[model samples]
Target chain A: MSAPFAKLPRWADYGLIPLINLFVAFIVAGLVVMLVGENPFRAAMILVEGAFGRGQNIAYTLYYATNFIFTGLAVAVAFHAGLFNIGGEGQAYIAGLGVAFVALSLDTVLPWYLTFPIAIVAAAGFGALWALIPAYLQAKRDSHVVITTIMFNYIAGSLMVYMLVDVIKPLGSMAPQTRPFEAGAQLPKLNWIIELFGAKIRSAPLNLSFILALIMAYLVWLLIWRTKLGYEIRTLGFSSKAARYAGISESRIIIITMLISGALAGMMALNPTMGDQHNVSLDFVSQAGFVGIAVALMGRSHPAGIIPAAILFGALYQGGAELAFEMPNISRDMIVIIQGLVILFAGALEHMFRPTIQTLFASLSPRSVGLAAAKKEGA
Target chain B: MDFLNALVLILDSTIRLSVPLLLACLAGLYSERAGVFDIGLEGKMLAGAFAGAAGAAVTGSAWLGLLCGILVSVGMALVHGFASITHRGNQIVSGVAINFIAAGSTIILGQAWFQQGGRTPALGAAQRFEAIELPGAAALRDVPLIGQIYSELISGHSLLTYFAFLMVPFTWWVLYRTRFGLRLRAVGENPAAVDTAGVSVAWLRYRAVICTGILTGIAGCYLSMVQNAGFVKDMTAGKGFIALAALIFAKWKPVNAMFACLLFGFLDAASIRLQGTPIMGVRVPVQLMQALPYILTVILLAGFIGKAIPPRAGGVPYVKER
Candidate 1:
């Protein structure tokens, strides 16, 4: 074998790799579809159409994308800071519960405008607090954030089940969920825009929550690329020792990064409660947090990349539901299989493809000069 | 007599619960000691449980099922080892992949094979592993205090329970007393040094992970064939993580891990007992009791347990320089 260090790819070469990775991923996805006895072309067409074939379908897809945006941004923020953040699920859970409490308690008395801001703030605050514990442990005692956050997710799940089943059960109902929010508490829909699509689109709940998600995405981008704090986060992410030499406090960065990630995760709850489902329900936020990991990975952990990645995932999710309805034999789980394969291929893409590309490029340019040398000589 | 009874009850519950955790923790100890972070323990356990139950249901022998469970889990461990050790993939991502596959595939297979709605058919009492009653323990039953403790605490668990306890000391001996143990530690701490000394770091880590798989299989089989007598979807529920915590909390020492498992098991038992019990003149919701173990784990891990250090190079894959 050659020198072990010789195989390592330079950091600058990572930019063009994602596009090739995505193309390879789609090829793999096609193979998977063929294995499942479906025509890849038909399946791909149907999937795209299901997401955007009709105006209402497009609206619903965007609605799903809104939640993914928040959670994906949450995971990306931590990924940028070198944190895995498996606890987005738990943070979102607590934040959702916080939103529910505020929505139910203040719905009757507070005006719609006042109640909406209060609910969003409460959700974000609760999420930040939920994340603070694991962050503190990791910073202070060197505890592994992955294990701690996962434990907290289980605890959060159980607590939510308990709250829904016993404490917060609706007064007159036996259902294992909270009561629906009052009319005043619901986020106002974009009714005027829906008039153009006629009666079909009016039924879907397209509210102000999607706008909030977009704004949050833009803000996250600014925070990650523009600010001094962002510089510290990225520096520490690349190398902790270098960040320390640069006089950035690692502990403070960890805490602040986690809090910001948690707050973004908290905002994800608004998509279900205030937009699509119109209330805090147990099934409303199923595995959105876990799916965020895939979103972040597919997006290459960038804010702008996250939007399209979220839309892709949202399309697949909606398409899967439609397939389940149309073909009962296939089951809804094929989407999970697709999601798993996408993640597997995408995560391994860099390791698998970088060397192959370098070798291919090396053969084409026989002098064996590196890419940087070639570019410098050309310049 | 009352005090002895309470002590016996606690001891019995502790042993019963701790066996699974202890086995899994020791398994984690081996894997981490060889520098592979085995977070797929829960998924492996679930796979083992499903395979074990299916094997027993078909073969009509619990022992055969136990062996089958170990074999299936070893397959999973091999996959994990190959992905992380051979392919040099991210250990955490590979572990997560195994977990997702296990979670979905097991339930799908169970539903298809058993027609039991994501659960295996329950085993009859005779088909399950029987508890061993020590000879002369019945005669000691008349002694009031010590007799109750002896009969209840030591004599009535399945043979696997006894083996689990024995493995703790055996592990300690192997980890500290044997040449393999030293090499294993060296590989985890500094694989480059081990490679320089002419030891195959990859082979050692592979063996360590395989051992973890076997132990995890036993824990899973014990849960399904002996303790609960059936399999359920995602039944291991984060016990693998709890065991990981115990492994860390004990500083990856066998004896310390034994006690940590016991402490966690006792909390689990106490949580069960606390349900439906009145506290402060009001009945407490059982969910709070159920959440106690996780809450305690979080608190303990959050700067309260002094400092728990992971093995250096714990999750890094070793590639031998030729």
Candidate 2:
């Protein structure tokens, strides 16, 4: 067989290909916008301005990115171990419950400093607990994590519905929600830190959680690249038989990786529940967990890659919300079509244009020319 | 008297609720059995529902609506085949993308055409598949013990529900008793062997996926034109996923998948019935019953009932060495 286009440069393989895919996705999305009777360039400008026009807008985009970072990391953690832990959504939902329970139970008793740390632990712990069942099932029972996680998402929804509607709704209120947490339970916004640097900052939902997400990203990098367990996880992913021969336990790695992934997913709850909403409400996790799949795919499951990929999606989401407000015809749901196109190109049809691009790159490179000539002579 | 009536009512709802699940479960079965795992059943169903509603509204005929629904679903299936079979893309990612597109496009188109908040116009009786009365319904109702259960719980269902029930047996027969079924099963387990036997693996999988699309189409039409009126935004909800869970819980067998779907339907009926009702001197939350089926599915998959092994060739793209 031909040699997979004679080995493209690292920059071409990692950066250029993804960029090309994104360009293709955007082009399709533009056509969709045109079909809806909007000028594609104008619509594109709207998205760009909405995401980065002002300090507050940038803050909002970053806030959204923070959620993606947590969830993308969660997905990436599992991807490394060759597990598709689609339970990130359910894990995050269930973890929100844990966060809500801690904040509700302890906000009055403890100070902000203590409460914040406890809530973070609560979120991660709950998320991990939620993920463990499926991990255990996959490891021991031969159950597919994909199916179990999907089921758990439904169960989580039902659980949340019960918690919000029947058990936690304030006695006098008809809304399906718990009472707001005490002031101490709320997270501080990032503007305080920005102001310390003597720059005027607009108030947005951007919070300390953004900083936490960054820290988590760094920690994930350390875990995946610098540690022994990481080595085991990567080995198992590459080849189970090889890993088994090397005395690396497949089941153990699957469980550990899923647990870490679940914890990271759970950390996503910190943004919407603790950082912004200040209450566990209906569908609070929304689609962040699902969006994480796209982020991880686009980022190629790397922490360094995930950061920028997360930011790009965050912009799309924030900008989509803006487009909904500006255009009367294109509603919020229509934005999903664009998101779907991006996902289709970035994930499903990710390599549709790869071979062509590889060939194009190879023909241009001087080394490939020499290699091709040498192969022809040998033939 | 009240307790018996409640029991009858619950059974009645259970039958209605299981129709979509049964069809979608069978759809998943067909695809997976042919080595093409399709989690896009939900997306296909959504598209079918929209097209059905729109077609019925335009033509004023339920029969025409059904055709439109099937066409839309088939289109979706073809797209899935192109991505997963031809391009060798990740099946789950393609499924998820289909879902996103279906979910978004349906709402967008609905809003554009109907201007009714992402919903089609409420269909008239002529544009819907109404219930069919079983023979001697009035005579059967007065019989002492089994009368109420027979007449109230089983009879007078919509035509689609009966079709869904009939499909269970038909699916079983086809899988076990037909030449095509053998080839389908073999392709799923060991495609290379079937390929060696001169059967095209890609063609078999494509055929199965297309069959899935057709079944899901009828399921979607049933939802819009029979169970309820019109196409609502995200009307399929998580039914497709639940159908998947049911499929797994049944160990990918046709008859068992039907039972699993029924069980889920019963759970849904029970939840609706038990809502706001006191249990053991305390009010039980409606969500408890809603969650029961999913919780049970997880337990079943976790090996409480038994292990569910998927087809050996499932999720792996067939790569032939040229």
Candidate 3:
């Protein structure tokens, strides 16, 4: 293989890959919808409308994006550290429990000013603690973090169910969730901002959580690209033996990275708990942890990349929900197909796009493959 | 008599629960031993489960369904092998993708086929794997300890259960005693060295993965046809992952993997038993009992057990220089 210099054509190179992947995802989804006797075009239209057709839908998309941002950032942090942290689900579950407990327990005694921040902190702390176990194992025992974290998700979910049903039954409620937090414990809405747009526009329950998500994303960017600690993390992630040789403690970095990642996952609960929901519930965590993996992959594991990726996912999620509601035939399973496709394209076929596109363009052009490139250089 | 009864119950449940895991883990053992990580076992098994259920429901033949399950899972394994082996893609990502695809496609197909909303039609007794009591075992039940031991150790299981148990020794024999086993171990430890020695590393790993797919398919079929009588969407749950953990905790040895499967199975059975029994003057919530196996896996991995080393090059793809 002499250098392997075939490259993607300039005109269709950047935009074509995403478009091809989007087409693939929609086609797969269309097949499934069609199998269920639903019109594919109508279902696709419904999905688009659900995500961005109206102001309310856009707000809902943003509301969902808030959780996606935190979870996506959490995954990106660990991915940067070269660790696959599948335990985001478990950490988020534990953090949700922490949020619920703090919100409910402190609602009566503490004022909103102090309670909200404390609750968010408690959730993050709990999330960090949850991640600590797997980090310790990976650091000390050389156990794979992926297996341990996946197992912990089940453990965390079961533990939460047990706690909610038995020990923390919320006074008299029988549901597998805590009682609603007092009004003060909830995150205040941005209704005033929505009103500024005027004309009967009611913003969804999106709140300050979106700002916190953005801040966390920025903080992750700083930590990964700007700070010394971030340098140590990236070095260790690239090659642990090299990092160790370079005088960085791989164990310490692993533990710290996991802690930060878990804390971000824990913060994800803020969107659901502090928004109009006002309480943490089982459905609140709803695969946000898993979807974070897709977000991180779509974003190419960069903080700047993750914002658009999260919004894209948020749109898909919001749209899928709308499709389900509007068309009784299409189930929420279509979203799973779309997610799976996005992840497949963004992850497995990621590197192949440039080569594949180059090959296609080369075949389409009558001239020799190197001729176009030579012409461009000559120009 | 009561002790004998409890032993029998435990043994029966152990065999039933351990079959799926044993097959899956043993499959995992072969793949990992050949230097390929198989996190897609869960997805492969789910695919198998759905295929088995659908095949059985349509054809009304459990045997054909089992074959169908294996075929579907093998198809998935081929995809996994191609992606990781040929394309040199990330094993973890490929496995996760297979899982998501399996999960989504199964439910989508299940809804379309069964019209029961992601669950299959329940099979008749003949369509399920019936328990097989050994010949002359009926007389052995009259004896005291021997009867209990005979029944608990030797009798009362589906044919697949015995097959799963026998696979442990068979796997060990293959790994330690056979030429192919030596080559597989060699490849897993150092594919470059194996390649230097003229063995095709990619071919060996691909075979190991296919073997895993077949075994996991049997495991998934067992779940649908015997354990639950039919398939429920996502019913295999995380059992495949639990089996993977067991494979790791056992250090990837076939016999140790069997013991690990039993250990987990016992915890599973014990949890179910404990849920009925009172703990410290109060009944333990069923959810805690349900969580026992996963909690134990985490605890065992977290330095409670001694070091558990994975096979060298377990997740790395083999790229041959032309």
Query: Who wins the lDDT comparison?
Result: 2
Docking class of 3: medium
Cα RMSD for candidates in order: 4.0, 2.3, 3.3
Tens-place lDDT per residue, model 3, B259-313, is: 9899888777777666658867887777777777677677777767776777788
| Residue lDDT tens for model 2, A112-214 | 7788899999999999999998899899888888888888888888888887887788899987877898877888888665456554665788888999999
The DockQ-derived docking category for candidate 2 is: medium
Model 1 residue A284 CA deviation (Å) reads: 4.4
Error of 1 at A156 (Å): 2.5
Q: DockQ score of candidate 1?
A: 0.35
- Tell me what TM-score chain A of model 2 achieves: 0.95
Q: Model 3, A32-136: lDDT tens per residue?
A: 788878899988788888888877777778888888898899999999889998788889889988888788878888887788789879989999999998999
Name the 10 consecutive residues with the lowest summed lDDT in model 3 chain A.
A1-10
> Each prediction's TM-score against the native?
0.88, 0.95, 0.92
What is the Cα-based lDDT of residue A7 in candidate 3?
58
Better of 2 and 3 by lDDT: 2
B292 Cα displacement, candidate 2 (Å): 1.2
lDDT of each: 0.79, 0.87, 0.83
Pairs of colliding residues, candidate 1: none
